[model samples]
Target: MALTYTLDNARSLIAVALIIFISWLLSENKKRFPFFLTIGAIAVQAGLVLLLFAIPNSQAVLSGVTAAVDGLADASDRGAQFVFGYLGGGQSPFATVPEGGQLPFIFGFRVLPLILVISGLSALLWHWNILKWITRLFGLLFEKTMGLGGASALAVAANIFMGMVESPIVIRAYLDRLSRSEIFLMMVVGLATVAGSTMVAYAVILGPVLPNAAGHVLVASIISAPAGILLARIMIPEERKATELDYEVTLKYENSMDAITRGVQDGVMVAVNVAAFIIVFVAFVGIVNNLLGLAPPLNGEPVTLQSLFGYVFAPVAYIIGIPWEEAHAGGNILGVKLFLTEFIAYIDLGNIPADAMSERTRMILTYAICGFANVASVGIMTGGMTVLMPERRSEILNLAWKALIPGFMATLMTAAIVAALPAQLFGG
Candidate 1:
């Protein structure tokens, strides 16, 4: 035990147990809790982690995947530079504060454009049947092990690569057929993983802070899918057998160009919404912080929203293997992710001084916040589901609240899994 793992990792395993217990406690049908389902879901995560991190051969393969993703982000940068010039990392006319220092990156010009390129490329891959085969392979795993019906299994698998609302489009005909539990699972898992387009963008933002950032986020998304499943079942056990056991991918596109065009259009909507939310939410936080500043000082510092949130989530941070000294900062990032946005949380993470937290804690946090889980996502999921099944609008709205905690817990569960493993697995 001492050689293969560290003492700190035990706390993370305990944290996972606590999360499971809490989910079981909150279950709508505790007596009907799916023990094997939980075990299977957990096993899937542990297996993937071992394959990707524990084994030398798999680690090299994982590295190759990450390198490919990094290359894709670099390709996106080329497109941005061509259009936005120096602001997008082209030669700069202005002088730097330090000689030969590169110009500061402008987020709109350099980063967000990755969404457009990646989204279009993803659509092209789907058109070529590449993603469909990948989705099917993963879907089969969930279907056989977790006992999810075929449609729900595929959607859950697709959530690893598609947006919450977008994944359901592949199983549109079966939207009305899903059980209440399955519907809630869909909502939670959707919130638990990120869209394929934003995954690369986030990796770019945190590249400096986290080595193999793209790989970690991608692995995090995959791990969170099953974590979400386990929590969803514990919270809302299957009331009836899932009706989607036998399913096929129904989503299609005409040609490669059409795929690219439609994907870019979808990417535009996501990019715009992301930009708008960042601007508005940051301003809103500032206004709230100003109001909080009016309060009396605590510990020689004026209390602000981040501090308050830090106080709330600090214990959670410690449980997930972050040292107590840095828990407050870690907690603040978690609070930002749950309440505002993971994108903002990642940005805040980038801004944190390197010396403030150990690399392991930073890696723990990188996986922790790599999801779409937030208050806003509840709205997105509900709205998207309602559009797909207008008849279930009221039920969807009602289940929206039930799914929120599970969604948030899913990523935390992923973090706990990361924390439980030896730091050596992450090259720390």
Candidate 2:
């Protein structure tokens, strides 16, 4: 057993090494990159993954927290049921069976409302200063260990709880003082992690397939914070003469009532935006797939855009610990995820046959798709930052693509770290 475990770990390490090499190879100023900082970041990521996956006690605690979050999903469903009645949370009204079985996979009905509940909770927590304190602690730790400084670290830390859109507000007052590298780091971190409000929604989506769905998503976002910053620095090696530094976090809520109200309003917009985006994006994908379908069919199946993506990214899936035979399927998921959105990719995942993917492949893909690293996020980041610091609009536009490369790479590194762990983390 020990020998088998060691060999599996060796394979995982090779894959991780590949990911790092690929990251370095893409470095803009390779000579200027602080290699030691990159190494330390990877080491920290690996250690944290072990603490979350290999250690029974810590993993159990995370699993318990996931269960609690899962329960929140259940509670949200009940609330939806109360409002939308049968269509709300009542077993996905889009069944395609002769007997009309409950599909339970409608995005608008099942996933949108979750944004409202968790968003409110996050707001209440922030109003109570719990989130601020936690971000401060993590920011200081990142400053001391990763040299990310206070403001950049705090914004990244806030990405853990808030959505990418709201996190930059934490460091809004210091935007002008930030260096170009710091801006890229902030954008990548945002693009690389999802908000707490939607984490529950994604958790609800993946829960049926992954028991520790919330736990895994949480771990992916947290680890990707450091990984994202590290890769950003590597790709666009910090060019500032001195350093971008800010330690003050002066933002505060007016009151608990105000927080709850604002939180709900923001969440409603998010839910509506998500619903429309998913609807439109899914339709667009179908249109593109149809256009690609005009190509010759292969193996009795039409050659669609998804198949083309699979062909390009299959090698990536294989190296990341997916079984070889299933690599094509995993590759398609990665493409749809990066090109479209994880929301749709996860919907694709839910439909794939369980026998087609091994538990290991499933676990790796789960973490990989946990982030907001799709093409849409690039525009979102560009627009958001342009609004926050219009003076740096030129800089934000130029590095948007640069930040995106590492945004996805950070999640890949997270998946690689998870790949090294035992299958028990995936749960039964």
Candidate 3:
């Protein structure tokens, strides 16, 4: 028992050390690595993972809270049904699919509209100041624990429930005022975390296949937030001590009706953008794969982009504690998420053959791929922030790719933390 515990701890520590070492290697000011801050950040992330999955009392409470994420998906379905009708919203008029027949989820109808409902609800929550209050509570934690500037902490906390670009909107006033490191940290944090509004769609797709998938996704977002801050600081140390900025809260609706209207409007735009991106990007991948397929066979099969990505990222998979043999499979998902986005990655994961990934590898990936980390996120975040603070657009562009470094680092760090835990902890 003691030996097993020692080995687990050693592997986990090594994973973290490797991540920090590599991040430090890329630091702009290599001499200024924030050792204590890095340690504190990792400790906090590890503690949160433990509380959610290892401690009985904390796990029970968190399970109840995260279970509500799944409930939100159900509620969104009811709303989706009202607008799109039964088949469109994915509620079959008949109770079951005919044997060997299909009721596969339709993305346009079933998955896309959940973003709308969540946006409207989010707008109303903002109007009521509920989200601000919630964000402030978390903001305080990061501020104290990580000694981050006020605006930076607030943005990171908001990333827990908001999308990458949307989380920074709350700090728009301070956007221009923030130091370079602070702005970069905010961007990376945004890319590193998934929005609450989008989690509903993810839950619907993954819930049936993975046990308590929503809960795990929720935990992944939470743990990734601090990791973003920590890695951001190490990779690009903040030169100036943070001064508390007067937070100007802007995400409010004039009234109940206004909230709903704005929410739906925002949701519509988001859904449209999402659909368009998926349509174009998926087609792009298909075209690219076909082109790659023309190449000579590797092993017994033609070389596809997906397999290439898997082989490329296989080492990262191994570092994150996936078993040696399964690392290639795990790398494929990690690569997909990094190259494309978690949306496509989750879709691939949901549709994989039963034997594609071991149960333990599946668990690690359910956490790893829960973020907005992708190559495109840099552009999305840069464009979004440029609109809010055009004066700093150049700086935003400069740090765009830099943001991806810690953005992915944060999420992958979370995956490694989970990978280090005993299989028994997750009921393997």
Candidate 4:
């Protein structure tokens, strides 16, 4: 049976409040007796969730977002086909294939071409200043509404345009001046967010396997942003005197050509890192599975690391509204996302036995696992921050562990919101 509205709202409210309380307890100012501050934070977080549901137009709002996401997917696909010609998975470039016959191509031949096309188009958009304008608008909204610093607000907003490290470059000049708490918030936000450029690729990869996959992924990221800020602030309250927030939109490049070139170069590096991380992490998981398989009853069986993760995380999956039958499978993907990257997790989700999971379970899991907050990303974030501000490298390193908790919490909060929504609203 579905949960009653009162029960659903109560559960969600308690979840948000608990997150704020936990954040305060874990932060450095335990001796400060920050009860009033904690209460206010919890109130704000709960109020946001309630506001989303309280509106009579809430369903329309979600539908509009879903439609916009689908439009972006359609446009991105068309752009991909134009840049890569037939290689981007359209009709044959030079020769036509027989009506029923399949094209002779390898994985890299098909997928890598799409990645290149998206990367190039992203560069072109940035060069035209389209992406910058969008970032600035979002930055202004976040800064004015959320009461965040200019640099942190801009970096978080730019996340929709670029990768974690790349977004930080938007406010590179202000990194050294940010307070320890603010720096921690920046890291948490970076970890919790996903880049827009990769959204196209992910949509293409999972669209075939899951309905509205692209739309859900976009919603997941957007919903996670506010939660990321709330959790990060709770973990480390703003301590230093507030500076005047600025909303300047500028791209650090010599020319349009240089911007495109640099953008593509950055994209290539991202793709390579993604590929390398997946290969190594999958192998490591295999090793662990092999050891686990050696147990007498499990020997020579198909038991894998995923199975273990499934068993370990199944309870939490159920708490997020996954059906009992599919919770274990959803749990496995969640585990992979946390330990490895979302790239591998999405691939695993696409291949998981359909009979083992319902469509609703799959959609919620996709939303839940759509962030850059994996264990591997921590090292990437730390190394990137070190280069950006050598003096604050120690501070970045110190806050790394705390940041991971809020980052993960942000994604979980998104999952909870989606889970609490009526399933029929998004075609679940």
Best by lDDT: 1
- Candidate 3: worst-modelled 10 consecutive residues by lDDT: 1-10
lDDT of candidates 1 onward, in order = 0.86, 0.78, 0.80, 0.69
Q: Residues 243-327, candidate 1: write the lDDT tens digits.
A: 7544443788989999999989988978887898889889999999999898999888899888988999999999987888989
Q: Residues 211-284, candidate 3: write the lDDT tens digits.
A: 76777877888889888888889888999978576765545557989988987887887788678767877898
Model 2, range 283-396, lDDT digits (tens) per residue?
Answer: 998999888788888778898888888889888877776777888998999999999888888888767776767766877888887788888778777877798889888998
Q: Which stretches of candidate 2 lie above 4 Å from their native place?
A: 1-3, 6-8, 91-103, 241-248, 424-428
Evaluated against the true structure, the overall lDDT of model 4 is: 0.69
| lDDT sort, best first | 1, 3, 2, 4
Name model 4 segments beyond 4 Å from true: 1-17, 30-99, 103-107, 243-249, 298-302, 353-355
- lDDT-superior candidate, 1 or 3: 1
Residue 231 in model 4: lDDT:
76
The true-versus-predicted C-alpha distance at residue 87 of model 1, in Å, is 1.5
Clashing residue pairs in candidate 3 (N, C-alpha, C atoms within 3 angstroms): none
Model 3 error, position 278 (Å): 1.5
